[model samples]
Target chain A: MPLRRWSAAAAPLAGSPGTKQIVVARENWRARAQEIAAAGGRLMALWASGPAATGRPAPRTLYAAFVLPPGLLVLTMPDDLAHDEYPGIEEVFPHASRMQRALFDVSGWRSSDPDVRPWLRHAAWPADFHPLIHETAPTAAEEPRPDDYAFVRVEGEGVHEIAVGPVHAGIIEPGHFRFSVVGEKVLKLEERLGYAHKGVERRFTELPILEGHRLAARLCGDSTVTYAWAYCQALEGLAGTPIPARAAWLRALALELERAANHLGDLGALGNDAGFAFGLSQFSLLKEQLLRATHAAFGQRYLLDFVVPGGTRADLAPEGARALSDCAGHLAQQTRVLRGIYDEHAGLRDRFAGAGMVTPALAARLGLTGLVGRASGQAHDLRSDAPWAPYDELAPGKAGATEGDVAARVAVRFDELFESCRLIGRIVRDLPGGTHLAAGLPTPPEGALGIGLIEGWRGPVMIALEAGASGSIRRCHPHDPSWQNWPVLEHAIIGNIVPDFPLINKSFNLAYSGHDL
Target chain B: MWKTLRQIARTGIVTQPPPTGDGSLRLREALQADIREILGRALCIRVVDSGSCNGCELEIQALNNPVYNLEGLGIRFVASPRHADLLLVTGPVARNMDVALRRTWDAMPDPKLVLATGDCAATGGIFGETYATRGRLASVIPVDIVVPGCPPAPERILAGILAAIRASHAHPRSR
Candidate 1:
């Protein structure tokens, strides 16, 4: 209650309507996190900043955002650069350990967490040479070497290991999966990611504030709209620019389409993984049709560059809007029938029913979030919880399932798909006529902190932006909801057969590029 | 069962001829003939994401969709590099994945083609040469063909795959 009261008094950030952020003292950092956890608040993101190679001369700082009743509560705690040690929040939020390790890999600052094996550094860089620090000196080993990740072993009779990818069998992103199993039954599963790290955070500093949206858009291919809009929201907030009504509606339209497209693809893939190729064929056709329609309405098929700073890149004409609405209407009807088929399919249901079960208790303990969280009875949807701009007007419905299995996740995706389709039709029809893009604005002041949080297709996609001297980007951290979900996946797979991994994985479909970055 | 059958009947075959613009029909036939002579059966491909944003992977995955019908065209994405004739690599070669990429290329049999799809694969795209990224996949491995786009469309990727297969011939089409 004190944490809420404290955060409530803090200055409000733009775009995040109900959210408040404040700098907390180092002594109160761990205590605050415990308070958040006790109050049933989920940690949205955890990141760190030490001495950087360029422009800024800020001290080592630890930052975290918590989702509470009054929206997101952002906290900042600074540590001295010299010994570089800070309190860890992993005990409070179990998902914080990997994040802390990742931040340490990037910034050379250590967390109090016991597990210190590198998360993002795969021995590509020197183990001691941190990339995010200014005063970092290369300590050892020049040539890049293969990382020998230490996977926790399950030593017992008949217990063996099944080591899968960074290079998976599928046409998907890279991340290594270690399965400690007895025969076909899995005893333990640990994921070693960061193979997809392209130094995105470090690359953020090199970009200008205006051009940051481009890189943000590419943070994750599937959630391009979300990341772009969040980045732009942060930028616009920093610059004190108010976007036109039409652009806001346009953004919502794009977001819904993105949600629908990804859901369609995942549902189809889930079916294929469960040995029902018919679902794959049908959903693939629907998704393809939707993408083509999207391209015709907007410029791009995947909507990679449609969202820009201040607003959208262009306006949707009446005809284009009608076309998109028509497409959505058609998709809505087709998917409704398909959903019925999926529900009635006995064999598919058998495969999906109990596979990869994550009970509500386990989900809450592990800090599960996004659509996956909703499947496990975590009633949190940012569109409903923290409605911003068009979402406030649109007030989209939330869909949830409490079963917390592959079936539950499938059911949630289906419900969301239909909701998104409905939203698309509503947005296009009720779009206010006005200028889409805002006039070119002035740069935000140096040291200004801007936070933008949007409910992406996956979950809440947040961009923490800080302005540098002369409109340079000091640091930009884009956080995906996958960070909270990926750890829960390991829990979800316990006691399940090896073959069902794909089906469960497709059901969750957490972002590798976004999380690993 | 009847409902499922009816749904299938309602949605007949959505697959159609792709728009690859390979000049005349004779040229297309000639290319297919060359592919048949070099490789007796379907062309097998292995897609490796060095460090892409998963944008190119989406389009590449779409190649198997009913519209593009990549498998129907005598091309299939296989699990292992050993079975693949063409290695489809995407994204800027992240430093971490460099060794893995090399091992994948090494695993493939002789007379193989490496098609670096997307601008990132071709020239490291937006996340260019940096400490963490060794830009342009060729810095890590030999690139045979480059399909340029932020992410080239599914149709374009299909065209690139076909071209890679035809170009995979030993003693050479260029010669």
Candidate 2:
């Protein structure tokens, strides 16, 4: 009944296996978005594709994917370049405001939303110039001007602004945070990102479809394995290539290892933010050892570019599997002890508990996903909800906490670290015997589209790939969960003290480069 | 507290030996000599990410782990560039971050060293000269040392920092 209200035609995704595509009439786009939201579907990603690949004088297509519990539902609507305007669904989905702004800036489509302040266009180029449009390019007449971003002003007695960096004191990726504070209490926190935007989506068009995985892997250094896997899934699906069973299992193994490494690092950093240097030293040591083991197993420390289209670039030797198993066993033991110490430490607990709380209702309203969402009772894990290949077999048990605070996030990370360790152990023990590489993939017909939705360590990392005529990438959009989670950080920081900001932020730890791209 | 202490006692001294050769020894010796001759007994470093993927940042953080013990070498990261002796910069200097990077460079006092880490910062590794990126740290500011890898290892980053310190001492500024 809910599905019949707005969709003109609905069918399963042809090239992409796990999703369904719904074609809505241009006039019914907003109505369909409202129907999806009314049915409690969370907006996973919102992106727009340029008309360059569809020949001259074509309309740009805007796509929005919603997670509808059973599966993913995608809606597509076209925007004519003449009008350059579309119905904004921000009223239905509050998180759609910034996404619409970003889509407008890149594709030159204006949304109906009144908040027209630039999201990604930070005055590096002219206001009229849009990057994703093939016809538009910055000319000599359009010189770079000073970027005076009109940050939302907070006015009152003793209300002042504290601006933190695009270049921070810590060795972190660039993003400016403007906090409207009175004394130490933060009234509002506004983030100005996109400083690390490297035009990744535009670069995807230039690379061969098969080689786009390399660029995807570097989308965010910490989530390399997840991004690479997601990209490969989309590419292989579009090409209708069936990867080897062994390769699928091995990819899961790498993903779990990557998850464990990140969780370890975050646990330690969270401790360090709470003034426990000992935890940082110990956890950092464990993370280093785990990375070394990963390097030995995968031939790359960060597992960068290891997962390519069709299959993986490298195979896991028997000796490497054994080493990985042993390393996982050791890490499990050490992490258990560290978790205990973190739990018992009063100072750490004091700093973590009840800090930067995001209620379950707030999380659902904002469409938060991944680890941050899980911490706040949004128990939507793609691994359990919609499993493909190896995860379907593994059936990873979901881990979640409903407290929605710094402690809850930490608890979720610990649970995930343990779960991922278990996963790695099982994957290596049940390592399949076959070729790791899938060969002879036939390219899909031109204009064919594929979608990949994988439960990355942080959350669901989705990649939508469209194939060009000559085995080239027409367009690719790798959407990070950070896009949905970054705005929620503002709500999380409300009423929290300035000093506690770092600790709360470390718990979420949304990737700046990932979101900026 | 007791548990932490017990764990520390059990894992007594897990500090691995400083890397040898691989150009690390020579750089360390040069740095020690330069510190003794020029500035003092300690070095304060400030880190900046122009537009990196955070891979180089991870490796830089690894330098402070128990294995590397960067603080034992009398080198520490500072919160402000004004108090820093060396600036460890990463990424391929994004177009939007160019002014910020230059301002950070200018904020450092006289007799400051800049060590550009990672291949992106050294030569704009994969994200070459694009409209969004200016490409490489040297294009924006003077780089005394270049540590090149997609993300150079922690040992290599340590060596590069030492080499930059030695170079800074050799060409002391007139301030």
Q: Fraction of true contacts kept, per model?
A: 0.78, 0.66
Instruction: Report the C-alpha lDDT of model 2 over A161-181, residue by residue, as the tens digit.
Output: 999998787867889999999
Interface RMSD of each: 2.1, 1.7
**Per-prediction TM-score to the true structure, in the order listed:** 0.95, 0.94
Off by over 4 Å in 1: A80-83, A135-143, B21-37, B167-175
Best by TM-score: 1
